[model samples]
Target: MSAVLDKPRAKAKPKAAKSALQTRLDAIFSNLKLGQEKLQLAHQSVEMTDPGEAAEVLLRTVIEDMLPASIAPMRREPLARADVDAAYTGMFPALAAMEGVIALSIGQVIEATLREAFAHLDAANAWMDFTEMGDVLPHREDITEADRSDNDLAARQPAAAETENVAGCIFDAYERTIEAFAILDSRVSDMNSGAAYGARSLVKVAVDATSAADETNTRDNCEHASCALHEAIEVLTLVTDEAPDLAAEGALALLVLAKQLLDDNVGALP
Candidate 1:
């Protein structure tokens, strides 16, 4: 009786392995669902904010949060907004001088993030495939023959559609993320250009306002144009301070890379 019971228990091993593989596949689907929900929240956040504030918030978010979340931890501290801005100011003879450097550096960051994102995506797909196919490992010949006819037929028909749907969802999330990053890059470029031009314009306005002040350069109540330009500058200052969430995600990711580089070469200037 003991020998017979042991024999039956041994035969149940393949079934147990198959059940484990199915469980893993379920977990993969659960994670995919959670990822999709997070993507939706990100999209809603972008859609809700005003453009300038949105841009600033996005920039801050990328630099401070999203990047760190994405990458492996580094020993060095990430570059803060003050650090990047100070670097921007110091490196440029004028704000306009920063155009090329900002474009190139930020562009590279965007590209690298997209590359890493795709790599992550491919890894996820590989895992999903493993979970889906692993059950056949034990009863290879029988499973193969059975799946060959049945799965082949279904795979060519409904299974193909199902696979495409899953792939589409995955690709859609990735594409949207990349697009968000691109928008952020564009926003930063625009904001920099606007600030440069605005600064030059403000200087001219100030000079005119000064000249008009009593002709002796002593004044009390400011003129209309100067006051307006000053107000504009204030708005821009607020913008710089705020930083948009979408841009923040990308910026944070770049800083994570920067942190890694910094950690490897300690005490090096950024």
Candidate 2:
């Protein structure tokens, strides 16, 4: 009977304003959400997607933080026409200024890519909305060769043709990734001794890969080295807050790795 009588008392309890500590906690959670949003956007710009920090691994996957360490290697070669073509032809239909041929030099190819990047920038700024990309932009999801369907190649000819802007997003993302890697590569000092040692090991692997005499084997080894350096970039990207030097060192190591690959294979260039 006493328990039943307490129901009326519970209903009569008055609501009260939040306490000072509760208010402070609310503000903290709001700020955290906003910070999380900005961080996600940064990832989208560089990685072409936002895998939000659902876990500790996701927190450091952001390329913007890793960029301070990777810039040098990204600019080392500036993506020769062959390298551009090798990396993107499957998705881009063509990697040069023309169809079925690579007549444009590396300078021309890189300039064209930059032009697309600037145009995208101009349009986005003019509209005052960066997210208004105007079309289905490139994402890492579309990067694999197997993802390049017959439909993409049939979309347009001369991937850089002025009549269509299909390849704009792909080239822009490519340029940004290069810039991020380059920036990170140039500031590679103050790294932890252990991380420095690990980076050196990657460099040694690239050196050994470059020393291969057989053409096919050399190219295969270079491919593996590129993948390894990419993984290193992903790893160092997490050290942006605690030990940025590690991130920078990793970026520089990636540049060295790329340089070795290009230098070793220059003989194959057309």
Top lDDT hit: 1
Task: Estimate the TM-score of every prediction.
Answer: 0.25, 0.27
On residues 1-270, what C-alpha lDDT tens digit does candidate 1 reach at each position? 688766754334544445765564455445434433443343344336533333333433333333322321111123122322333232212111112113323443233433333233333333444333533334323445655566446435632443344323223222323333343345555556555345334434433443343132122312332353344335434444564333323332332222222222222211
C-alpha lDDT values of all predictions: 0.35, 0.34
Judge candidate 1 at residue 182 and give its lDDT: 40
After superposition on all CA atoms, how large is the RMSD of candidate 2? 20.6
> Cα RMSD (Å) per model?
21.7, 20.6
**What shift in Å separates residue 166 of candidate 1 from its native position after superposition?**
20
Cα lDDT for residue 41, candidate 2: 43
